[model samples]
Target chain A: MPEKPDRNAIEVRGVRKVFGTGENAVAALATVSVSIRENEFFTLLGPSGCGKTTLLRLIAGFDYPSAGEILLYGDDIAPQPPFRRPVNTVFQSYALFPHMTVAENIGFGLEMLNKPKAEVKARVAEMLRLVRMEQLANRRTSQISGGQQQRVALARALAPQPKVLLLDEPLSALDYKLRKDMQIELKRLQGETGITFIFVTHDQEEALTMSDRIAVMSAGRILQVGAPRDIYDRPADRFVADFIGESNFLKGDVTGTDGGRATVKLSSGTEIRASLPEGFSPSGSVTVVVRPEHAQLAAADGGAALQGTVENVVYLGTDTHFHLRLDDGVPFIVRRQNARGGADSFAAGSRAGVVIGGDAAQVLRD
Target chain B: MASAEEIARAADRKDIRDRWLLSAPALIIILVAATGPLLIVLVYSFLTSAAYGGVEWKFSPEAWVSVFLERDIFDDTLSLADANITIFWRSIKLALMTTVVTLALGFPTAYFMATRSEKTRDLWLFLITIPFWTNLLIRTFAVLQIIRNEGIINTLLMKAGIISAPIQILFTDTAILIGMAYVYLPLMVLPIYASMEKLDFRLVEAGYDLYASRWQVLRRIILPLVKPGVIAGSILVFIPAIGAYVTPSILGGGKNMMISNFIELQFGQAHNWPLGSALAITVMVIVMIALLVYVRNTGAASGERRG
Candidate 1:
């Protein structure tokens, strides 16, 4: 079979999932539409109760959307049961069958599909090798370590050769070290299997490191869908900026506009240039988002630079954090690298100037 | 002043002694009150039966011999005791059937209860155990009232014109089976429910995600995971059912006698106390063997799953 690089492997069209009924109804996904390309590593990034897992469940056919369609390679699978779908999930808990051996767990999908015995054996052996768990094939899942159990779960889900593999926080249960290792391992497996991997996680770092593109969701709605660099460098709004990374929100008024760039007047009467959101024309007050690392401390020249008093100085090995109160009494944080001979040791209660880097400030539309 | 280590050791010894003293009463009661009658019955099995309804203090294996073999009254030849064999077969068969029927009924009911929300689960469990509040004999009689010729089932059928006359459901093996199953259903349900309630339902979701149908998920995952509870429930129901006295006597009408009823007859009408004791020992042996076989089978099954 030839792989179509440009075609969509799965498309969720205007999907809305409302749980419960009447007064108790809660919308977990509200009119969401996104397309996952073939063999692409897609991620749904959100915090708890943000409906990222709900979207993944809809794609895997474990859940049905209240109001829209889910298409797997052009065929609508919205009403189909999970068993009937050609997709599989790597659950957060691993969910390995405790009674079966690792090999049997890996072979379960094939066996359920009624594949031939020899075929199942061969596929299971291949999967065990792929997951680097050949030595633990005969071991009961209960006897395996958590990380090893995670590998077995991955092997089991991949053994079915699903069209799209939906991973629901598969590494959330692992320790920090193991989570890092599994993240790399998951990316490698996705590349090798050439399957469209739709991963869900709340860890922005994990999403940024592993996903080819991420859809940042908040409160049952997709805030922005873009590459990690695109999302980090140019967030669509204050919520996306705040959710993906630490950002300082400064209350500002739009003083002037120039195409995609706008001049915002800060409370301290300092006018700074910020990039505007697409097609948003702001005339009143706005929120300017600036990442901690985007601003640097300099001599308080008292001109064209936002000045603030250093409230706290925290040394954190590789970087030092300067928590300062801006002239308007708004708390702002600036992170400076602990480079040798390049450190600006500012004492607490000392006045400092924060020079916002060019094109780093993002003017929010709302 | 005594050394600290020596004082700690002495305190440990005293603690051990105190613990033993505290538990001694329960231990003594279990040994004497529980196993005391069983020991007497074991001893009586090897002694001779009195002319009336008691044992004679003389060593004899006649009771053990008569358990499986009896001398022909007219021919002076020993042969298999057909009546004893029949009663043993009936007892084993009914118990096995009752176990199977109760498991078939209890498994889904337990699963249903286990799947319910926390507040409602207690309600379901309470409902399952409601039958236990009544006396066992009364419960059996309640079943008799339902299945008897002039009882509710027959009257309903006659009224509905489904039958011209009442069905002779009572005084039959079916009646005893129904009664035993109803009586022991809670025993089967509770243990299985305990295991099922602890089950992680995510495993079922994983099974479905692996393309397993509903039936396949139940057969391959759910059933195997809950096997220990099934085995426990089966043993709980089967052991008492094999030796049940009341349900058989009431619903089977004394004609279809179980092993317990036969053993009772040996002491009452037959005046064979030694035979009754021997029969009781035999039932216990059968139960032990059944338990061993059950354990072995499940152990092998689990090994297969691992493999």
Candidate 2:
């Protein structure tokens, strides 16, 4: 109860959504509840059909839950129309009005609010500057590039200065370079506007880079909600572990526990120590998940190491990825930063040691 | 041998020649079948008429003058009073009425059709065209059977006790208008439906998201985007409805005469071929002028979308 101490910018409590009816009913979301704090850059990260978009739509007033309350800044706005809501969405398609000029599209929300012409003009000019689209203000939306159109959409949504901004995969259409550029721009925009941004994206890296806190959703349920570091380092379950980043899972039996750390003995009798996650059981089979980046390949060691022959060495601009396997044929990967340590590179068929620190590997419940 | 640049220019000229060659057949057909008759009619309008419903092979300005003047063949003085102008005005009014009524009725139906699922829209479109499969005269008579007193509609309404008297809906201007609309309803619907089909519903959603009221969004966004369809539908309905002959002849009881009906009288019972030609030429000129203006406006609107 004390965890969410501050006032919530948007609270979606006990929301359920079922599409269609009768025999064809689909449960898009079930018992979804999350409180987003003001000025927090929160992202709902999930694969397609995970109901992340459903939850965002419910908050934006584009959709209503079949059963539950949606409170925007402590006021229930469930029955209100989208136009009546104090939130704006940057749509996935960057839904710019093609008939209108960029400035007109940006100033549309202000015009709808009955703002004076001079004030609307000033705000629109400021927004154009904010999005670095001041020179393209007079051009029609159809005349702008995809990235420029994206900025116009962002500027248009932000021009209204809503309590919360909902972005529905706003960067999925952009290429890699542009998407990366906009991620930083979006973070800066959120910071400057000081508005709660509930962004939805399937891209894990995009979610990690822009969000202060992220809620990992799957099958219409929130699997975990925490800061980007927390979600990446200590994922709640196997699904979260496999989804966030690349990891090598080793099936092992717990041999012993040393306070916070537990030593697990592998099938090949190789003993490794790893930090136990919460509620970790002792003296049973467990799965030890270690990221490729966390495990390092060194000279064959005598203790606390899984010895394998280097089967492949791949140079990826920033790091070297070495594929190896234990004597029992258990495959392992080690991603070593190219700039770190000695100039020695492991060749295929060379004996190597896979060293994962106790805290580097994560153990999950089942 | 041609140089590289000269060869490129030659290839471009060959490309242009091939394009023109591909269109030549249709162009030839249009000129021969469509404009050929109109050109003959245009020539006939300036010629003199003989004593017994034939041409005299002489040039005269009498057919053009007769539209607004009444004069004896031997008389030098011309009276500005004429019934032809009245008939022309009445035909214009009736055609305008048909267009306005069909537009009002067809717009909503086309919008509904456009909003339907693809299969449902196809089914409705097929049904709309089914009426066109029948002969135009037969379709007009079919409407006659439905709306006439003591007909199916009258019997049904009387049987339902909604009407004690047989409704006098037959052989009136209302009947002609109804027949025209029923015949031309598909024309108005098809182009509008085509336009609406291509519309992005996301634009409407974006409008609503920007705090625009439904009506404001429709007026500001939906209407403008679909303007091309409305213009196309209007042209499709207007040009043909203005020159319609049979709908008025069959349903008008010869009382509500359109310009086509008047032109028919000139060529048939009235025996004034030059006058008919002149009136036909005049109507064609008017329709062309209207179409040119509409095309100009639509071209300007389409420019905004492109730029």
lDDT of 2 by residue, B1-307 (tens): 7799999999999999999999999999999999899889988889997766867789998999887688866867898745777777766677778778888988889889988989999999998889878999898889999999978999999999999999998888888888888899899999988998998987887788889898888788888888888888988888898899988899888876778988988888888889989999888887888789879988887776556
The global C-alpha lDDT for each of the candidates, from Candidate 1 onward, is 0.92, 0.87
Error of 2 at B93 (Å): 2.7
Residue-level error in angstroms, candidate 2, position A56: 2.6
Model 1: per-residue Cα lDDT over A78-141, one tens digit each: 9999999999999999999988889999999999999999999999999999999999999889
Q: Tens digit of lDDT per residue, candidate 2, span A33-148?
A: 99899888999999999999999888877788999999998899988888999899999998888778999899999999889999999999999999999899989898889999
TM-score of chain A, every prediction, order shown: 0.96, 0.92
Stretches of model 2 off by over 4 angstroms after superposition = A1-5, A254-283, B12-22, B72-82, B159-162, B297-307
| Candidate 1, B20-54: lDDT as tens digits | 99999999999999899999999999999999889
- Any idea what lDDT model 1 has? 0.92
